[model samples]
Target: MEKIFDNTEAALALKSDSELERARFLFELIKRDTLVKIGAAVTKFALKFRLPVEGLIRSTVFDHFCGGITEDDCLPVIDRMFSKNVHAVLDYSVEGKEEEGQFDKAMFKILKTLEYARHNKAIPYIVFKPTGFGRFEIYEKLTAGKKLTQEEQVEWNRIKNRYDRVCGKAFEYDVPILIDGEESWMQDAADELAESMMFKYNKETAIVFNTLQLYRHDRLDYLKELHQQATEGRFKIGMKLVRGAYMEKERERAIRLGYQDPICKDKATTDALFNEVLIYMIKNLENMALFVGTHNEESTYLVLQIMQRCKIAENDKRIWFGQLFGMSDHISYNLANFGYNVAKYLPYGPVRDVMPFLFRRAEENTSVAGQTSRELYLIKNEMKRRKLVKSV
Candidate 1:
């Protein structure tokens, strides 16, 4: 780990001066937590009231954080990233839909993405939220060991069918699909379902990747147990390791419900757990594949160090480094420049439907200590370097 992420030239190679300035402006705005909250409220209200705010939103935060409104809209970005050896995972960013029709539509969108991935070398993977394919209540009910009514049972079967269909299509296309992690209450059902998919489609390799929110104290044990099961069943395991996004919601729910908090005690505990799991996965790379999704330079470096120590190739097909689009370009691009596999999570959807995802990105940048500041620092450094060169 020789300070690879500091190379801003490689990181910002794809951004023009105007695009760089836009990124700087976005991060500067995201640095103010109060402003982010107020903006989120106003944006929600505007969208709900059908105000003429889409243009403002699209020209600012939306363009910075999202790919476009549809899969075809994402082709240029995907091709540009691939030119630099970085891949793309086109995530449809719609959220909070629960109707069967909506679920069916989401499944169709994913199937289309899989077909695109089959033909496009730039788009190596596709992702979807479990709730996007089914109702949250169904997952919660199932996770709680509650029985479903006749109607609910039919809904559950439809959800399972959605999973099987998309997974089977992904397997047929030979493109890995990442199933995202959600709240702890609903995740048990999703985890069990992901395991079954892996067992069914991952006999030769890991085609179905489940997400692990490592912020939870128990997920390491869960991963270990899953690993043991995969070994016993003789199927490869695929996992995307993340620190989780729903910490506050999880805490509030546990407190309200009088249950144990699922999150770790503090940031340090979470970081330690993440590192421990990283090491464990690297050590057992033969039986599994990993997608390391983090913006933390130290954690990214930790993975690089472990890979080097283990004598793993820089461009290991079974391991990938991923960061969200419009964030952490330094990490994503620099890793790719160094011959490592990297992918940016390119979220695409209608401006209104994608607001929740954008708001989360804003909140995350504001909540995570020093994240926005680090991004600003890198952006300014690159801008200053370019200016000095011009003056010279």
Candidate 2:
């Protein structure tokens, strides 16, 4: 079978020899279990005690995984990716903030991102987490059908107003906004709010996107329900489909809280569910705009196969592929090379504030079987092909 994601040269073309060498070293460290454990531990301790390790992190993983510490810092990366025909999605990745002031700040930054994106054709969309605008506990309470106190109610209203301002700006600029998925406990509120935004702004087309995590056993059904709602409500649907990021956290919480685990039974099941949703969305492309956000080779192939079967154009505006900025250049660059609409989820924030995001990337590479190994293999191949390596 011909694979769409096998173009190692195209994948690594944007990376300089030194960048590839650094990536190789990073992935090499990630592939070693003991080293990853020790590095993670040391990183945690250093951050806790205010030790000076930001420079080391900024040079290595942060540079690789994140755009930079601010929106302005992301411009060179955006231009570089756009030069390769890959678009960018600016994601403000600061997490675990709770104060109303912090929420307002996040909203301000996102609005600025949208304003910037309005002028930059290289950026297709902007994204933020719901928790970025409000407290997680409040979202959990709302999701659980619990009543909020008077002060909490006021806080909830403020969160909604923040969302409205951002989405309103997105609507004004004619740029779509993606609301990232969160843990299942808080997802219900996020989903409801996302739908409300869609209903308000998506009457003409999908301006507000809701991410669907297919690793959850119920998400396929949720997709079906949402499709029905869209049909009846007379609005276009925008969706970014992924295999889920918070699988371990969801399962651990379910176990500790004595609730059923929300994740699919295994990787195979998740893959099946993801492909099923992809097919469904493609079949209904008239009312749906889809973003395939996965690094899995088979899933990428499945999307190509389905698009071909459906006679959808390679550069259809309603369909796009997304991968994280640094992890899956093979997929992003290869797809974009073929004239497909592709974007990199470029995350940016202060280094210290974005450590949670960086640590998750490190842990994901270390824990996911073959993830780091595959990256290492591709980088080494590209290096050898360029004769950047004197000896193997």
Candidate 3:
């Protein structure tokens, strides 16, 4: 098998032969299409039948992906990440509806995460979605830059209050809250709202972070403009760079509307923009705190090189590396091992509510470049080192 990292010394620094053997066994299981199919089917059936799978899910993917069902429940896993020098971005993964009650629940949850984060040194950040507090359609409409009704405007005000409470709580606790990126149709509103919150809450420090999706053709430049705007306002900017989500939907919508697609022309273009964004952020490190959330080796390496050239500290508060909890342990653990600030976006919720997210992860791995293959290969390498494979 072709090695993704020929520098095996660097790659294997943290894992022993025994660990590698176990990884190989898991890799073989991950590589099988059958495992995902059976897993998804069982999960789907459990949801349909309303059978309890919390115990099973907790032992399987939940253990792999989530922090825990609650704050106190997550400490053991949080401590594990800390042992590896990985920070925790505790996520309350319960999706909220548009109703006022649900919005209140989400706000309370964010506040709770902040309160809990206050006492957890390993957890410096948490994430929340605007949709957790508002209707998607309302944000989609607002993104069209259309005028909103009094009622809609009032609702927007209430949404702002929700975020203000969350951010304030985080700030009082000296933790940060990341506002997640959402679908393109509603992304504009999300961006605008986050910026408004940043300008308000980011006065003394960057307490709120806005995720920027680089796949959009205009966003790289938009990031630059945002830098200028932040400079002008004299407020620190925080950005989390992601290649994108919603690619297929964006393409389909563009085709259906007889319009140019907003996405980059190709994956290479997206990658180029991602690296450029990192470069810009590194160059202006004082004015911005940047988080690179990627599994791409090239992008991750590029950030390291840039930081080295600029003599930035590995533990610089303005920079972070993040990976989803269940994936990319190599990058996360190794970088953390190297004394850089790294984090795992550890999500938590009940099984049914989180299934939507879980299924999407499985689907994405199956389609994404080198993801599942890479995962499987690493697992296999570990297993081989362990001599765990049975004779044919």
Candidate 4:
């Protein structure tokens, strides 16, 4: 396994004592009943900072969650990972837009990232959210089966052109781009757009990767349908699968609308679907390019077994493993050691908008079983090994 459980190494190398202690403290704080309150304080502090959080957010969260403040600036980390045989998917985490100018700026930033990736061997992929460049309500209406108004359609076309530019750059440079999934309400539209892009650019290679949230009960079926469509169309299908993130919102909306929830009934259902789809892809590797993005040990190993069973090489270009930048060192680092293609989804941006991303990670750690406990356990172990006594 090459000791993928080297979070202790990543942590000790990247975080100072105060930074590690703060992570440990936040680890403790997030577990208590006062989590929301602690979250509020963290948000307040993040807003008070400058570009990077220098000591607090940058040293801990940014160091853990992002490659760097800028795409080019991330070279050291990117080089380090590539030296370990891990690749990267660059994510610009600017969010909550309300202006056309902001949208243009976001597009410019992403295009710039794509241009930079053309020269960087380690950066094979880049990701962006539709919400970053299009209005959420506009997409919700389109995905809700509503006809778009003239202005909305025009706006949609422009936003889509921005996507085309991103994909076109990727196609030009022979790099791949992964379009992130959005809210359940807007995912259908995202999928349609991503599918269209894939058909356009992925006729030869898997360049456009659409995210599939298996937490949705229908996505496995959707993956099957998409695979069929891609085969019939003679195009390669690319996918990044995750246990969906917005469970509470999906459930609440379903109940409010009095519809059967589209999400899986439980985590087990989602996990089962994820592994099955992964196996299906591994078996049909040539027709599909797979990015197995998860932290669960079995799911990660399940993909490994699928590749092995299918006689797929460890360095197969069609399959890669991924986990979010901050959270899953053991998965990515270890998988890379096994000579499999693996990467961290490294998010970078200014502090304010990135706070939402940060907050979500914290809450997710609290929600996921043993996530915090394991992190706490690791930090304490490393600290004790260093003979440093910590408070609480």
- Strongest candidate by TM-score: 1
Indicate the TM-score of model 4.
Answer: 0.90
Residue runs of model 2 more than 4 Å from their true location after superposition:
388-392
Writing each residue's lDDT as its tens digit, candidate 4 over 1-392 gives 22346556544544466756766776776666367457657556757764344556666565666777777667787887777777888888877887888888888998888877888878878888888888888889988999999999998998888889888888888888888887899888888889999999999999999998888888878988998999899999999878878887889999999989988888889889888888777777788897877878788877776667667799888888888875655567767767888888888886566767767666666667776677678777777766554443
Clashing pairs in 2: none
Name the candidate that leads on lDDT: 1
* Alpha carbon lDDT at 6, candidate 1: 87
lDDT of 3: 0.79
Task: Summarize candidate 3's per-residue lDDT along 150-261 as a digit string, tens digits.
Answer: 9999988888788888887877787888998878889888888899888888888888999988898888778888888898898889999898877878899989988889
For all the candidates, what are their Cα RMSDs to the real structure? 0.8, 1.7, 3.7, 3.5
lDDT of each: 0.94, 0.90, 0.79, 0.78
Model 4 segments beyond 4 Å from truth? 1-23, 41-55, 384-392
The residue-level lDDT of candidate 2 at 26 comes to 88
Better of 1 and 2 by lDDT: 1
**Candidate 1 lDDT score at position 112:** 94
Stretches off by above 4 angstroms in model 3 are: 1-42, 52-54, 388-392
What is the descending lDDT order? 1, 2, 3, 4
